[model samples]
Structures are given as C-alpha cells and as structure tokens.
Target chain A: MIRLVPRSDTPALLQVATPVMAVLATMIAGGILFAIMGYDPVAAIKTIFWDPLFGLAASYSRPQLLVKAAPLILIASGLAVGFRAGIWNIGAEGQYIIGAITGAAVALAAYPAPEMWIFPAMVIAGAAGGWAWGMIPALLRNWFGASEILVSLMLVYVAQRIAAWMAFGPMRNPEGFGMPGSRNLQQYPAASNPELIAGTGAHWGVVAAAAAVLATWFLMSRHIRGFHIRAAGTAPRAARFAGVRPETLVAFCLGLSGALAGMAGLFEVAGPAGQITDKVGVGYGFTAIIVAFLGRLHPVGILLAGLLLALTYIGGELAQLTMNLPAATVQVFQGMLLFFLLGFDLLTRYRIARRVTA
Target chain B: MIDPIALFLLLLSASTPILFAALGELVVERAGVLNLGVEGMMIMGALSGFATAHYSGNAFLGFAAAALAGALVALPFAILTQFLMSNQVASGLALTLFGLGLAALFGKPVEGVKAPTMAAGPLGLNWIVWLGLAMVPAIWWFLNRSRAGLILRGVGENHDAAHALGYDVRQVRLAAIAFGGAMAGVGGAFISIATVLQWTEGMTAGAGWIALAIVVFSNWTAPGVLAGAWLFGGVTVLQLRLQAAGVRVPVQLLSMAPYLATIIVLVAISARQKFSRRAGGAAPGSLGQDFHALR
Candidate 1:
C-alpha cells in the first residue's frame, strides 16, 4: 500500500520544479485526450505549446501574448495578495466588468473632449468603481460572519447581468443599427488604450501589469502589512494576538485585488475589447485565479504563469485556425494544467513511501 | 392569468434542478467536505444526459448517464483533497473549469439537438421532479435516523475521534462527494433534458452556485433546502411570468434577482450566526478540514 509522510521542510526549488513537471504531465495527458478526439495529438500539442511563438503566424501571435497576459498578470497580482492573507475574492470578473463600465462612462460622457486628463480620469473612475464593488464583500464579511467566497462569486452573475443591461439599454451605440454594444473606444483616439510602441502590443495595461508585479513583490516581501497578512494566513490566532486586525487585512486584500482587476477591465475595454457588451467579462477574471495558483502565488512566478497562459490563448486561436480544433480545447488544456499542478503539489507536502517505515 | 396549481407545478419543476443539487451538497457539507464543483458536475451531467438522451432517444437513460458522469468526474477531486492534501477550494474551482471546458468541447456535436420527451409521471409532473421531491424526506430520514448516516456525521464532526472509534473518514467523505456529484449531475440533466430540451454552452449558468447558497441557507437540513429551493424557484417562475406579461422591467435586472437574493440570504444568516450565541451551531466540526490518519 502506498503511504505518504509529511515533510519537515519543503524545498523552494522543489516548489518551482513542480509546475514544470505539471506542464509536462498535462502535455502528455492532453495529447491522450486529443488522440481520443480523433486528432493528431502531436500536431495539436505542437500547435498549442510551440506554434504561438515559432509557427508561421508567430509575428501576429507574439504581440498578442502581451495583450492577453497583461490583464491576467495585473489581476493575479492583487488576487495573490488576498490569497496570501487567507481572504478569497473570487469575483474579480465582476469587479472587472463594473470597472469597465465606470471607466467607459467617463469617456462616453466626455464624448468630444480632447482633454488629456480624460483618460487619467477614466482610470481613476475605473479603480474607484472596482474598489467600491470589492468593498461590498469586505464590509459584509467584516460586519457579519459571511463567506466572502460565496458573496464575491454571487456578485459575478450580478455583474454580468449589469453589463448586459448597460450594453442593451444605456451604452448601445447610436451610430450602429441597433447593435447591443457601446461606442467603439478603438476609434476614439483620446479614449483608446493604444500601444505604446510600434508592434509590441505594449499598452498602459501591460505597463501597469509589470508595475503590479513589482509592487506586490515589494509588499509581500518587504512591507510590515505584508508580514501581517502572511502571519494572519499561517496563524490567525497568533496574528490576532500580535495586533493584526482581521477586518483591516480583509478590506486591504479585497480592495487592492478589486482595484487591480478593475484597472485590467478598464484597459481591456479601451484596448483589445474596445466596447462593452453582454460578453464583456470573457473569463479573464476567472482565468487569473488559475494564474495566481499556477504562479505559486509568487509575483515572479505569476509573471511567468501569465505569459504561459497567454500563450495558450494565442495558441488556442491558432489551433482553431490552423488545425480546426475546438476553441474549448484551450480551456480544457488550461483546466488540465491546473488539475495536474494541484495534484502534483502533493509531492511538496509529503513523501510517498512504497512500504511503511518510521 | 396563471392558474394557482399550474404556477405551483411550474415552481416544482423550476426548483427540482437546484433542489437535487442543494440536497447533494447538503449531504457533502454535513459529511464535512466543501466541494465547490457543483456547477461543473451539473454542467457535465447536463451535457452527458442530453447527449445520451439525444442519441438513445430515451430521457430516462440520459438522467442515469448524468449521475454516472457526475460521480466519475468527482473522483479526481476526492483523491486530490482526501489523499493528496491539496486545498479543497483550489481543487474544486479547477474541477469546475475542467468540467465546463470538457462539456463545451464534447457538447459541440450535441448542440441544438432537442431531447426526446420523457413519459410524464403522476399528476403530469416529470418523474425526475417527483424523485427530487421524494429525496427531501428520504435525506432527512437518513441524516436524522439512519445508522450509516449517523456514522458519517460522526466522521464529519470529528474525524480523529471517529478514526479512534474505528470509522473510516476518507471512505465516508469519498462516498459523500460521489453522491453529491451524482445528485448535482441529475439536477443538471433535468435542465437539458426536461427544461431547456436542448444542449447549450454554459446553460446551467449559476444554478450550481445558487444551490451552494441554499445549502448554507438550509442550515445543512434537507427540509430547509426544500424551502430555500422553492423560494428561489418561486422567484424565478414569477420573474418569467412577469417577463411574459411584457412588463417594462428590464429582463437583465429581473434575472439578477436570484443572485442578489442569494447574497442577501448569505449575509443575513451569517449576521445571525455572528450576533447570536449559537455560533458554529449548524456547521459540521471538521467541515473544510482535510483528514489524514497519522502513522
């Protein structure tokens, strides 16, 4: 019988190695899945993992990696903080939507204004909108014994509905013939989140994502509040005794994550998405949760994980075009990667033994 | 105007999916495991049941397949949390993503195909609906009066003590997870087979989540779950009725009622627990805590 013994100490290197192993395992398992689906597994795998960067369409896909990774990394950076503090805010998708709406409201209201301050103002509104939405769960949890996980998750549906309402009722483009979407921000130069350089796909959101990683790294590893968060997660009672306020930590974590997610949403609407629609959320908020976990909840790790996941998005699209694979194949691949990563995390916590021995 | 009895039957049909799911989740939570993959399992069940029923032209067989698929899909979560000691929350979320993606992938071929009509049971209600109603009393009886149920409760309440008393915590939790998955699956199948009558991507929507909220609202009781399901079902039915009547109320806002209601209920119950003396009264002792028998 197989038995597991708890390790006295988990090696840092082993933790890093585990994700790589999980990736390899997912490739093998995903290949099997593809084979069963009657596709050339090797070609499918190559298309997904290698083709985005090396395939014939690499030129277009390379820039897209940044465009996709930006939101995921930005959102995950904030989520990692909350996760570290034992707070769960699973409604980033909702926050992102609300943020986009609020951020775009500023631009839409200032229709013909060529003022340089409009975009900055929109950014503020976006962050504020996200903060307000995130604060709902934080306040409820602080006031009551409510589960933030359920509360936050419920809000996602609520947010989706709100996005739908806005798209159909208020934000419907007047110029378009009864289309259920906002005015295209892409066409509005002042409002648009344009690329900073020629073809690199580097927008303000991408820059902000890189900044979030650095800020989070410093906060978690340097700041005393970060120490409090770590302490609260590991030993709640001890952290309380040491004067760390649970409510404050809860608010800080939720608000920070919410704000970051909102910014991500704002950038998306102004850049790649270009308009608010019923389908605005697009699962980026949900996928970022996987990114956080995949990154081992570390800032640097999250950067790499974001890029890897972005690769899947681009590669999944490429696969759809080149190999005629179902779009869900990428989703399945993402899900499988997370499953394997979580399963293999067992190795870091315990040692497997063939026969029992003290 | 909608007839009173007709409205009641509509409510019953509407509530059945969530009822099945909430009841299954109740058993799981009572057994001290929090499996958040109800949404995933239900979607899997929906797809599998719809596909099976579509192919075989037998709706009954579709429900059966859903139950089986749900159980099979839940095994990996059980192993990860029960044996591997992974975080239950993360694993459960991953399970949902996996199920949704897999279902969407496989559901492509079955999309737009209408389900064969299932033979109606007594009183013109679907058999699955009646079965869902019957499960209420049955689960209450099992949880309150049965010997195996009591042992399962003990394992959930105190795994270490239960292990000392020679009970297997892992086995009990595993069984509970599978049952939960199966129930959720059937509930999901009800949507595709009986209600929607066709397969659609992400059609289960947030029914699984609403089910989770109901488990909390039920205080982990079967009859309580029934009441919560009816309340949600009633809201949904009324909302649909209002829509049909061509009221000026925005459909999107109307549809958001159930989710907002869930949030309100969760907040109210949690506040009561926080302010009342009976803190941690209804929740199982070992809920969300992984159990490992030390050597």
Candidate 2:
C-alpha cells in the first residue's frame, strides 16, 4: 500500500518544486476533463498551453498575454507585499474599480481635448483613487477595530455600484445615443494608454508592472521598512519590540496595494478595456488574491505566477471557444490551481504521519 | 390592521441560509477553528444539492447529499490543519478555493437547470425554512445541554487544558468541522431548493462571507445568529420589494444593501465588544489558533 504521509523536513528544492508539481497536476487533470468533454485532449491542451506563445497563433496571442499579465503582475505584486506582512486586504477589486472611475473621470472631463498632460494626470488620479478606497478598511481597522477582510470585501460591492452610477449617470457617452458607458479612451489619444511599442502589446501598465516588481524586490530585500513588515507578520511581539507599529504598517500596506491595484484598473480602462462600465472589475481583484498566493507572496514568485495565471486564463478561453466548453471553466481552473497550490504548500511546513492503534 | 403573519413568514424564508451557515461556523469556531471556507463549502453544497435534486427529483435527498458533499470537502481541511499543524488561515482559504473550483467544474453541466420544487409541507411554508428554524434550537441544545457540546466548547476554550484532562481535542474539533461543513451545505441547498430555485454560477454571491461576519456579529451565540440572519433577510426583502415597487433606486445600490448591512452590523458588534468589558465581553481564548499535541 502506498502511504500518503509527507516526508519530514522538506528541502528547499521541494519548496520550489511543489508549485511546479501542482501546475503539472492541474494540466493532467484539465487534459482529462477535456477528453471527457469529447474534445481531442492533446490538441486542446496544446492550444491552451503551447499555442499562445509558440503555435501558429503566437503572433496575436503573445501580445495579448503581455496585455493581460501586466495588470495581474502589478496588482499581485502589491498584494503579495501586504500578504507577507500578515495584513489581509481582500478588497483590491473595489480599489481597481475606484481607480478606473477616477482615472476615467479625469479623461472624460478632458474629452475632445488633445492635451499632453491628460494621461499623467489620470495615472495620479488612478493611484490616489485606489489609495483612498483602500484607506476605508485601514482606518476602520485602526479606529473601530473592525475586521479588515469584511470591510474590504464589502467595499467591492460599493465600488461596483459606484461604477454603475458613473457609467449610467455622469460619464455616460452622449455620442452613443444613451449607452451606459463613457467615451472610449482610445478615441482620445491624449488619455489612451497606447502600446509603447507598435506591435509588442507593451503599454505603460506593463512598464509599471515591471518597475513595481524590481522596486518591491529591493524594498523586501534591503529596506528597513520591508524587514519590519516581515518581522511583524512572523512575530508580532518581536516586531513591536523592533519599533514596528502595527497600525501604521496596516495602513501603509493597504494603501500601497490599493494604489497598485487602482493603477492596474486605470491602465486597463484606458488601454485594453477602453471605457468605464459596470464590468470594469471582471473579478481581477479576487483573482489577484490567487496570484499573490501562487506566487508564494514573493515579488519574483508573483511575476512568474502572474504570467502563469494569465496563461491559464487565455488558455481557458481558447479551450472554451475551440472545444465547446463553458466560459466559467477558466474560473474553475484558476480556482483549482490555487486549491492545489495551497494543499501542496502544506508539505513545506509540516509532515504527515499515521500511527497504529495499540 | 398590519399583515404581520405574511411579513414574518417572508423574513423566515429569507433568513434560513444565513441562520444555517452562521450556526455552523459558530460551532466550528467554538471548537477553536476559524474556517473561512464557509462560502466555498456553501457553494459546493448548493451545486451538489442542485445536482442531486435534478437527478433524484427529491429535495430531501438533495439536502442530505449537500451535507455529505460539504463534509467530504471539509474532511481534508480537518486533516491538514488539525492533524498536521498547518496554518489555519491559509488552509481554510485553500479549502474554499478548492471547493469553489470543484463546485464550478461539477456545476458546469447543471447550469441553467431549474431545481426540483421544494413543497410546503403542511404549513404553507417551505420545509427547508422550518428545518432552518429547528436547527437553531438543536444547535443551542447541543452546545448547552449535551456532553459532546461541553467537550466541543472545552476544546475551543483551551485545547491544551482539554487535552490534559484526557479529552480528545483533535477529535472534537474534527467532528465540529464536519458538522460545520454539513450545516454550510444545508445552507447552500436552501439557496437552490427554496430561494433561487435554479442553479447559476456564483449564485451564493458572498452569502457565505456574510455568514462569517454574522458569526462575529452574533458574538458566538445561537440566537444571535438567528437575529442577524433575520436582519439581513429583512434588508434583502426590502430591497426586492423596492425594486418591485418601481422606486427608481439604482438596481446596483439596491443589490448592495445586504453587504452594506453586514458592514454596519460588523461595526456595531465590534464596537459593542470593545466597549462592554463587563457584559458579553470575552472571546474564545483559542480562537483561530491551531492545536498541536506532541506525542
């Protein structure tokens, strides 16, 4: 009989390999699912995993990957920082929506203009919008001792309503004859987040995401503040002794995450999504939680995990279209990846054993 | 002259799922475990319940199936965190994600299918609603009037002390977790069989999260869970009535009522907890902490 006990003292290599193993497990499981659906499993798997970057459709899908991965990496990196500090800010979706609304508000206010300052102003507004939204939970947890998780999650619904109000009320496109959305940012070149490189799908958001990863790496590795955040999470008593104020850390981490998520929302609205609408959230905020975890809450891990998640998302869509699967299949797949990664993560910390009864 | 009877009945049906989920989580936490995966378990229960009802055409069978499904999903959680000493918060989150993904995957085919109609057995009220009401007293009795309940509460209060007294802390917690999963499952079934009467993706829609908050807001009491659920149900029913009445409120704002109410309730409860040191003051000593027994 094969025992399922985890080995004692998992080595560093196993720490790194578990996520990889989980990914492999998901592929095998997903391939089986495809086969059960009567699609050619190999072809379906190849299309989802291989085609986006290497197959006949690489040229088109490759750019889309960067476009999709950019916001995820940016948001996930910010969230990973907070997660490391043991600060749970689950409302990034709310921050993302608020950012888009704020950023787009700036552009919409400046519509029909060709000013060079419009986009930069929108970026600042985006970050500020997210930061302000994030502060709600931070302040509540600080003052009222409310649960930040609930507060942040509740804010998502509030933000969604606010977004709907914007699309239907103030920001409604007058030219579209009463549609519930704002003017397409693409139409206003000044506000549009145009691809930095003509065909590479590189946008200002991608650049920001890259910068965020590098900056976070330095902060986490070399900065005193980063050390404080880590210490607070690992041992609150010790961190307090080291002069790390829990309240301040909570506010700072929550604010920083909100800003990044908000920036992601702003870039998405101005670049890919192209308008402020009710669907601006698209569950990215919640998905970023998974991205943060899959990335092991590390800056570098977040980068790779963000791309991997983005791949699954693109592949899930591909499988849906080509194999007659439902759109929700991707959500299920993403959820499974998080599930397996977390389950496998147990091996890193504890070993399982069975004892015989006397 | 007011039709208090109909208003009261409407409140009961709406509050059933919250009541079930809150009570279940209250039990889990009372045993010193904080399982944030209530939402995921509820969703799994909803899907499994719907699928079973669709196939078996029996609401009772569906509820039973949902309970089983919930317990099965929660078993790994019990094993991993309770036995292996994994981080409780992280493991609970994993259970939720896993349950959600598995539910979605399994629920794929059941999408768009209507649940079998749950009949009002002898009282003009859906049977599930009645069962939900009954569960309140049952949970109360279990916690205050039974030996197992004492052991469960004992384990939650201090696992080390309980273990020293020769009580099986891990066993008690494992049972509580399974029981919590079963209740969450029943709550999910209530959504399908009694509330929506249909299977839709993400239909639970933060109900489980609200239930978690309700556990906190209720200050870990059974009657408090019922009251909180009714408050939520009242908000939901009012919103639906306003929408039907064509009050011209933004539908988005109307839909956000329950979530907003949850935050308000959370604030009210947390404030009360902070201020009232003499009354209803203490929290479970071992709440959210893992219990490890070194052999």
Candidate 3:
C-alpha cells in the first residue's frame, strides 16, 4: 500500500501544474461518464470544448462567450477580494438580484423617456443596492457576532422572493397585459446596456469587468489597505498587531464585493437579460464563487478563468442543441471542474509519498 | 382554528431531517472535525434515495441507498482533509458545489417521476417520520452514554491528549465523519421520500444549510436541534397554509419565511453564546482545525 508523506517545501512547478493536471483528469473522467451514458465521448467533448471556438458554429457562440463571461468575471473579481481577506460573503446572488431590481426600478421609472443619464443612474442604483444588501450581513457580524456565511446565504432566498414579487407585481409592464416581467430595456435605448461595438458582444459590463480586474490587481498588490486585507486573512493576530481593524476590513470586503456583484447584475439587466424578471438573478453569483476559486483568487487569473468558464457556458448550450444533452449537463461539468480543482489543490500544501511500515 | 394536532405532526416531520443531520454532525464535530460539506452530502443522499426508490418501488431500499451514497461521497472528503491536509473550508465548499452539480446531472432523467409514496402506518404517520422521532433518543443515548461516543468527544475536545492515550485520532475521526454522512443521507432521503415524494432538480432547497445552522444554534445538542427543526418546520407549514388560504402576501415571500427564520435563530443563538460563558455557550475547542501528527 502506498502512504502519503508530508513534504517540507512546495515546488514552483507543482503550483502551476496541479490545476492543469486536474483539468486533464476531469476530461478523462467526463469522457468515461459520457461513455457510460451511451454517448460518443470524443464527439461530445469536442462539441463542448472545441466546437465553441474553432468549429463551424463558432460565429454565434463566440459572441456569447463574452456575454456570459462578462458577468462571471465581474462578480468573481469582487468575491475574490473578500475571500482573500477571509470574510466569507456568500450572498452575492442575493445582491445581484436586488441590484437588478433596484437598477431596473430606475429604468422602469424613466420608461418612454430617452435620456442619456437614465442608464448611468441605473448603474449607480444597482451598485448601491448590492452594497446596501451586503452591509446587512457585515453589520450583523460586527455588531451581533453572526456568521456571515449563514446570514448571506439565507438572504439569497429572500432576495429571490423579492425579485419574484417585483416581477409579478410592482415592476410588471403595464402595456404587456400582466406578464411577470418588466419592459425590455432593449426597447428603451436610454436605459439599455447596448454593445459599445456593433457585433462583438462588447458591452459596458465587459468594460466594467476589465476595469475591475485592473483596479483590483492594483489595490491588492500596491495599496496598504490591500496589505491589511491579505495580512488579516493570513494571520489575524499579526494583522491586529500591525493596527489592522478586523471589523473595518470585514465591512469593506463585504461592501466591495456586494457592489461589484450588483454592477454585474445591472450590466446583465441592461444588456443580455434586458429586463427585470423572476429569473433575473439566475445562478451567476453562485457560479462566480467557482470562478473565483478556479482563478485561484487572483485578479489576472480571474480574468482568464472567467473566459474559460464562459466558454463552458457557451459550449454547454451548444452541446445541448447539437448533441441532445440535457441543460444541466453544463452545471455538472462546472461542478466537476470545482471538484477536480479542490482535489488537486492538496498537492500545493502536501506531497504524496510511499511509506513502509516496520 | 389552530389544529394543534396537525401543527404538532408537521413540526415533527420537519424536525426529522434537522435531527438526523444535526445528530450526525454533532458526532463528527465531537471527533474534532468540522465538516461543512453536510449540504452536499445531504443533496447526494436526496438524489440517490429518490432514484433508488423510484426505480425499485421500495422506500426502505431507497433510504438505504441514500445512506450508502452519502457515505461514499464523504469518503474522499475524509481522505483529502485528513490525509492530504487540504484546507477544510475550501474542501467543504467544493463538496457542496460538486454534490449539487452531480445531483442535478443524475437527477435530470429522474425529474417529474414520483417515488413510491411512503405508506402511513397505523399511527397515521409515515415510517420515516417515526424513525426520525426514534432517532432523537437513540442519538442522545449514543452521544451521552456510549463508550464510542465518549471517545469521540474526547478526541474532539483534545486530539493530542487522545493521541497520547493511544487512541487512533485519525481512525476515530474517520468513523465520526462517515457516521455523520450516513445520518445526513437519511435526512435527505426523508425529504425526497416522506416529504416531497418526487425527484426534482435542487429540491432540497437549502434544507441542508438550514440544518447546518441549526446544529450551531442548538449549541450542539440533540434536543436543541429538534426544537430548531420544529421551529423551522412551523414556519414552513404556516407559509404553506397561508398560501392555501390565499393571503395577501406573495407565495414567493411566504416561502422565504423559513430561511429568514433560520437566519434570525442563528443570530439570536450566536448572541446568546457570546453573552453567556457557560459550559454549552462556547463552540467546540478544536472545531475547523486539521490535526497533523508530528512523530
């Protein structure tokens, strides 16, 4: 029997190679899973991974990559900042929903009026809405000593309900004869998040996501506040010794993440989603957590990881249409990625070894 | 009219899942390990139990399958966190995500298919509900009276001391984790078979998370878990009743009451714990920390 021996030091090569290895392992496992399901594993894999970028149907799917990746990257970027500081704010989904509703509230209030400031006002409302929602957990944790994870996650169900209420009641479009959705923002150019470029799917959300990447990279690497965040996560006692306030860091991280998630929600509503609906939040907030982990919680890495996940989303949809796979197959695939990443993450801290018992 | 009998029965049924999961987790925590993957394990159990029962038309077999499935899913978590020394928080999160995904995948085909309805016995309650009620006392006895339970608690309170006394800390922990997984599995099975009676994607709907919080809110006690579960169940049943009554509130908002109640309960309990420094006030000494033996 092989026994694992702990190593004293981790190598640089192993740090980079583990994620790559995990991906390969997942691919093999996925192929086997497909075979078991009586599907052509190789062709199915191609449809999911290869066809989205290089295959004949790449034209339509290519633009979708950006559309999907934009929100994921935006949300993940914010989540990563909080995660790095060990402030577990798991309710970005709730924030996202509230942001969409708040943002759309602004747009709907200004319907039929083509004003330049309407869209900008909607974006601000979305960000502020998310920030306010996030502050609830942060304040509770600070004041009453509540677990942010439980509080934040619980809020998600509440937010979903609120969104449902808005879509079915207050925000329901008057002219649409009682549908459970608001007026499409696409029809109102003033509040719409139209593409900056005509056909490439490059919209303001993508721009904001890119800007967030750069801004977070700078904040984490250069700013003193960032140092405090990192120090707090690595060692709370030491950070306290260095005059870092734990409660302040918790609020900041939670607030920043909430705002970023809200921005992603706003962009989505104003762009791809195009209206406030019962399904406005989707699962982007939850999926963004995976993206944050997959990116290893680094800003630059988050950008690349976001694109890769976006590719999977496009590919999953394409695979569903072309290969007759179920819609949830993508969720499973993404879940597999997280499992493999986590499983392989062990290599970073501990090395496996063979041992002999005397 | 308040129908106290119906209310009591609903509360009992709701508390079953929480009791099973909390008791299991209580065992695991007593072994000095905090497994946050309870949600994932429960979801796996839900899907597996539903699938097995749907296919075989045996609710008993379905519950057994769920327990086995939950234990199987938890094995890797034990290996990675215990042997490989991976971060417990990260591993737990991954487990939840993976479990949710895998359940959705496997449950896709099983969607809309009804499981074999659990027959109401002479008592007018399903067998699983009775079993859940029975488990409360059994769990209390196991944790408070059993030798294995004492050893488990000893390890949780102080692993190094337990190790010095020649107890296999790792082995004890593994057993506790497996036991926890099995109990959580039964809870999930209860949801699918006794409650929902149908397989739907993501049907557990944060019940696992609520159970996790209940364990904390209960201050890691069996009776407390039962009370918390009943409280949540009351909220859930009341919401359903309100919806049935066609109350002015939206159904969506009504459905959210339980989750909100959970958060409120968690916050209240946490505050009480902070203020009171009694024996049961503090969390377990070695919670969420991985043990590394230096020989």
Candidate 4:
C-alpha cells in the first residue's frame, strides 16, 4: 500500500507544474470523453484547443478570445483577492447582473445624450451596484455569522430574477415592438464600450481586465493589506492575533471582487453583449471560479488561465458550428480542467510513499 | 378557489427534492464532510435519470441510474478530498462544476424529450415524496441509534480521537459522501422524472444550494431538514400560486421567494445556533477540513 507523507513545505516546482499537468490530463480525459461520444477525438480536441487560435477561422475567432477572456480575467482577479483571504464570494454572477442593470439604467435614463460623463458615471454605478450586492453576504456573515458561500450563492438566483424583471419590464426597449431587452448600448456611442482598435477585441473591458491583473499582482505581492490577506487565509487565528480584523477583511474582499465583477458586466453590456437582456448572464461568474483555480489563484496566472478558457469558449463555439457538438461540451471541458487541477494539486503538498511491510 | 389539499400536495412535491438532498447532506455533515456539489450531483442525476427513463421506459431504473451516476461523479470527490487530502471546499466545487457540465453534455440528446408519467403512491404524492418523508425517521435512527452511525459521528466529531479508537476515518467519510451523492442524485432525478416531467439543462436550479442551506437550517438534524424543505416548498408553491392568481407583484419578484426565503432561514437558524450554543448540533467539527491519516 502507498501512503501519502505530508511535506513540510509545498514544493515550488510542483506548485508551477501542477496547473500545466492538470491541463494536459484534462486534454487526455476530455479527448477520451469526445471519443466516447463518437466524435474523432483528435479532431475534436484540435478544434477545441487549436482551431480557435490558428485554424481556418482564426481571423474571426482570435478577436473573440479577448472578448471572452476579459470578463473571466476581471472576475477571477477580484475573486482571487477574496480567495486569498479565505473569503468566498461566489455570487459574482449576482453582482455582475446588478452591475449591468444599474449601469444600463444610467445609459437608458440618459438615452441618446452626447455627454462624456455618462459612461464614467455608469461605470461607477455598475461597480457600486455590485459592491452593494456583495455586501449582503459580507454583512450577513459579519452580523449573524452566516456562511458566505450559501448566502452569496442564494443571492445569484435573486439577481437573475431581478435581471429578468428589468429586461421584461422596466428596461424593455420601447422602439422594438415590445421586445424584452434594453436599447442596444452599442448604438449609444457615449456609453458604448467599443474596441479601441477595431477587430482586436481590445475594448475598455479588456483594458480593465489588464489593469485588474496588474493591480491585483501588485496588491498581493507588495502591499501590507495583501500580507494581511495572505496571513488570514493561511492562519486565521494567527491573523487575528496580529490584529487583522476578520469582518473588515471579509467586507473588503467581497466588496472589491463584487466591484470588479460588476464592471465586467457593465463592459459586456455596452460592448459584445450590447444590451441588458434577461439572458445577459451566461455563467461568466461561475466560469471565473474555474479560472481562479486554474490559475492557481495568482493574478498573472489568472490572465493566462482566462485566455486559455476563452480559447475553449471560442473553440467550443466553432466545434458547435462545425462538428455539431453541443454548446455544453465547453462547460464540461472547463469543469474537467478544474477537477483535474484540484486532483493534481495534491502532489504539491504531499508525497506518495511505499509503506514498508514488516 | 384553489383547494388546500392541492396546495399541500404541491408543497410536498416541491419540497421533496430538497428534502431528499438535505437528508443526504445531513448524513454527510454528521460524518464531518461538507459537499457543496449537491447541485452538480443533482443535475447529473436529473440528466441521467431522464435519459435512462426515456430509453428504457422505466422510471425506477432511471432513478437507479441517477443514483449510480451521482455516486460515480462523487467518487472523484471522495478520492480527491478524503484520500489525497485535497481541500474539501475546492474539491466539492469542482465536483459541482464537473457535474453540471457532464450533465449538460449527457442531457443534450434528451433535450425536449418527454419523461414517462409517474403515478402517485399515496395521499396523491409520488413514491419519492413518501420516501423523502420516510427518510427523516430512518435517517434519524441511523444517526442517533445505530452503532455504525455512532462511529460515523465519532469520526466527524474528532478524527484524531476516532483514529485512536481504531475506526477507519477516511472510509467512514467516504461512505457518507457517497451516500450524500446518491441522495442528491435521487433528489435531482426526482426533478426530471416527476416534478418537471421533462429534461432541461440546469433543471435542479439551485435546489442543491437550498438543500445545503436546509441542512444548516436543520442544524444537521433529519427533522430540521424536513421542516426546512417544507418551508421552502411552501414558498415555492405560494410563489407559483401568486403567479397563477396574477397578483399585482411582478412575476420575477414572486420567483425570488425560495431564494429569499433561504437567506432569511439561514440567518434565523444561524442566529438561533449562536444564541443556543450549548444545544449542540450546530455544525460538524471538521465539516470542510480534509482529513489525512498520518502514520
């Protein structure tokens, strides 16, 4: 029998190699899954992993990579901050919805206006909306000792309902013959989150995603608060003894993550998604959780992980269009990636040893 | 006017899935493991059950398939967390993500397919509903009276002490997690085969999370889970009634009932747990911590 011997320190080489190993394992596993579904496994794997970036449709799909990656990177970066402090804000989806609603509300209320301040003001509203939504769990945990995980998750359903209400009722486009969506923000230039350089998918959201990656990297590595956050997650009692207030940490982590997720929503609404529809949330928030883990909860790692996941999204779409694969295959593939990552992560903290038979 | 009996029946049906899932979670928690992938497992069950029922023309077989699927999905989680000593919370989340994805993938072929009709067992309720009701006392006995149950609880209360006492802590928790997965799967299958009578992506729709909250609301007791499930079911039934009655409130707001009710219930139960510290049964001592059997 083999026994796992706990390592005194996490192996640095394994720390880096595990994510890479997880991806390779997922590829092999995912390939087998495709083969079981009767598709040519190699072609399907190539379609999902290669075609999006370098296939015949690379020109079209490459740009979408950034568009898809933006929300993921933004949300994962925010979530990573909280994850570092052992604060789980799983309701970024809710925050994303509320942020889109609030931000779009600003644009709709100031419709067809040529004001410069409208977009910036909408951004603030979006962030604030998300921040407030995140506070529900934080405050509940702080005041009543509720589990943030359940509270935040429960809030996602409520946010979805609220988003539906907004689209079906209050934000319904009047000029579109009773359609259940807001006016396309893309048409509204002052509020649009358009690509700075056409065909590159380099919109304000992408820029913000980059900014988030940098800022989080700086925060985690260089700041005292970052030190506190890391300390709290690793050693809660010690953190408390060192004067790190648990409530404040929870509130801050949740709030920051909420704000980032909300901004991602706002950007998507104004850019690629182009409207506040009932279906505006398409699981970016949940996917971001996978991105955070895939990246090993590191900011730079998250950037690469987000891009990798985005490749799967673009490739998944291509696979659906070309091979008649179901759209859900992408979601399944991502789920496998996270599962493999967690499984492989075991190697970092422990070594398998052969038990000596007496 | 809506008949009270119809409303009660609807409440029972609506609550059945959550009740089943929560009961399973109650056992898992009682054995000191917190599995958050109830939603994922439930969805896997929903998909597999529907697909099986559609192909075999047998609902019972579908449910059995679902239970097996759920347990199979959860096996990875048990292996990763219990044996490999991975983070329980992260592993559980991965299980959920994987389950949802795998379910959707499996459910693709069954989309738009109609489920076989299920006959009522007693009191105009389905057999699963009755099973859910029966599970309360059955589980209560298993946890409170049975010797194996005591060993499970001992493992949960303190693994180190349990280890000293010669109990297989990893094996006990693995059994509990697998049972939880099977229960969650059955609860999920209940949604597809009975309640919705159709296969749809994400049909479980946060029922798993609500069940998680219910487990906590029950303070990890079988009876508490039943009451919590009923309360949620009542809210779900009332919300649908309000929609049918065309009350002035928006349908979206009405749809928020169960989720809002969950939060409220969580807060209330947490406060109660805080106030009555000596009452015990708050949470398992090692609920989310990964256990490693060191030599």
User: What DockQ values do the models have?
Assistant: 0.85, 0.47, 0.64, 0.85
Candidate 2: stretches off by over 4 Å? A1-11, A32-43, A351-358, B278-281
Worst 10 residues of 3 chain A by lDDT: A1-10
Model 4, residue B234: what's the lDDT? 97
Would you list the clashing residue pairs of candidate 1? none
lDDT (tens digit, per residue) of candidate 2 on B65-106: 999988888987888677556567767776776777678777
Error of 2 at B12 (Å): 1.1
TM-score of chain A of 1: 0.98
Each candidate's interface RMSD:
0.8, 2.7, 1.7, 0.8
Q: What share of the true interface contacts does each candidate keep?
A: 0.80, 0.43, 0.59, 0.81
Query: Which pairs of residues collide in model 2?
Result: none
The reply for model 1, stretches above 4 Å from the true place, is none
- Candidate 3's clash total is 0
lDDT agreement with native, every candidate: 0.93, 0.85, 0.85, 0.91
Q: What is the TM-score of chain A alone in each candidate?
A: 0.98, 0.94, 0.96, 0.99
Candidate 3 structure quality by residue, lDDT tens digits, B145-189: 999878878888888888889899899989988988998998998
Q: How close is candidate 2 to the true structure, as a TM-score?
A: 0.93
